[model samples]
Target: MPAPATPEAPAGWDFSDVVGSDSSLRRFLHGLPGVDQVGAEARAAQLGTRSIKTTAKAFALDLAIRMVDLTTLEGQDTPGKVRALAAKAMRPDPSDPTCPPAAAVCVYPDMVADVKQVLGDSGVKVASVATAFPSGRAALDVKLADTRDAVAAGADEIDMVIDRGAFLSGRYLQVFEEIVAVREACTAADGREAHLKVIFETGELQTLDNVRRASWLAMMAGGHFIKTSTGKVQPAATLPVTLVMLEAVRDFREATGQMVGVKPAGGIRSSKDAIKYLVMVNEVAGADWLDPDWFRFGASTLLNDLLMQRTKMTTGRYSGPDYFTLD
Candidate 1:
């Protein structure tokens, strides 16, 4: 028998627009408007000045809490560590039950089982960093195995790092194909497939132009979400870099009628900073992207800051770091 037919693209959508010969891909990416670095930075800085207060502040705080991908990706991470992280994710503020739980708990592939066991049926998701996470230097087979193992271990989402080496070397097609392959590897044996978030590690990509191209490349290659960084680099995530990514997702949705998510990991630690990011999302991607489903913060300490601020809002006083559990 012939091979099974692949599912059709969404109505009025065409994958051909993005997939093509190497030359065509280059032309397409190059044809994209060049990034005005100064202008982009100025805009991000300007948006950062917008002051959210009172009721709006409260709303944004809660939304930010829910959008967090409570993360712990470290050489020292253990099952005990992951379990503690999951507990914090389930109840971010021990003093107040009204504070919403984070959207997901992110971990390394080997720890997904522990996180799942801790979370049980609380509806919090488990996100795994795979595909030779933090460094996409492994063989393709190893990467795929890494992704499959995470999914089999019950990860609801997979954050895969793209081959920046291939991308910077002008091997755009290789990078795109890698994303597609890893996305496929997210499938579970029972026919379920975890959502795939492709990390561009824009810090190493070196230019806003490169960031824009990588964003489009990942989206075109079937990444359910295009992420800013892997949280291990110098400039893991920045307002300007994330602004460029948000624009890509917004534009992709306008053209394809398919909305892809965006996650900005690393460097975002304060409730104030998180709110500023929320403002950027609203202005750049519109209210549609404000929800946890479309946007996520890949953070570890960000949750605690949000909790402290949340307590301040509720009790009219700032709670020290001691108030929250140390995960």
Candidate 2:
């Protein structure tokens, strides 16, 4: 190796400010889901803002994405209502040709077989939630049993939420240990098998520093994907939170060379918003990982808007969200 060159500033490069300072750390901090400041108007402003409409190209990148568990969606999902929503979410209709091919159908573990049979030879995988979703407050034995049952039922992917209450209340070790055991459980029951996405419910965490730490903790604990929000929380999946996670992914990649995935579930209501997320990935994580395998948007309400946008792009006249049916 050549002798180390003296640390000299390259022309206009300013190292004095960042070479060794808290400001560097702050700059990293600033990048995490800076969403509190970006309200709906700001998000609206980002519309017509360079969208990657779901097209053959968008679907063709090396990776694949499945919109998991849209039926058990938050905001309006209730007991009697869930089954119908789950049924409709899995149903395929003739009118909506613009809908992208979901890599899998995500459902409550009970609905896995229903979706599996309905999707039939279409090759979409089946995913199920485990470890007591929405709130991961179950007894460890119960949670493990839940995981075992879902896998035994043939779920190809497992989307699990971490205990946010425990994580935020300074029980980091508890969360870490839980994820490790759950991951191990997945392996034992399903082979080194089902993909594990550890949902952080990032909206509930008070700060991005916490988000970064949680991201690291989840990945370190063997989570295949680190996700944002349960969509049940008040502030699920905003651009800023996602930005923070992407930066975390970047740093994690640099540090450990592990290519982790990201999922931004909830509140993604339109193709424009989805594109903004794609923009964040391009700008932050680079074009190399732009495929859906590395990123996903989880929302029942979003697919319609993405279809409407796709329709308008080809025909040049927009159809309102209402006119564009979700079937």
TM-score of each: 0.95, 0.74
Over 1-327, each residue of candidate 1 has an lDDT whose tens digit, in order, gives: 111122234644666855777888888887777778888899899999999769999999999999999999989999999999999899887668899999999999999999999999999999999999899999999999999999999999999999999999999999988898999999999999999999999889999989989988898899999999898998889999998888888777776788899999999999999999999999988999999999999998999899888888889999899988776
Q: Per-residue lDDT for 1-327 in model 2, tens only?
A: 111122232433322343144345344333434333334235434532754535743452212223433545344534345444434444322365544465555567766666655555655566678898878889988887888777777767788889888877666667777887888777644364778889988878877667776786787678888889777887888766676677667766665667788888878776556666776677666775575566766776766665555556567777786764452
lDDT of each: 0.90, 0.64
Q: Give candidate 2 misplaced runs (Cα > 4 Å).
A: 1-99, 188-192, 320-327
How does residue 311 of candidate 2 score in lDDT? 55
In candidate 2 the C-alpha lDDT for residue 94 amounts to 34
Residue pairs of candidate 1 with colliding backbone atoms = none
Candidate 1 TM-score, C-alpha based: 0.95
Off by over 4 Å in 1: 1-11
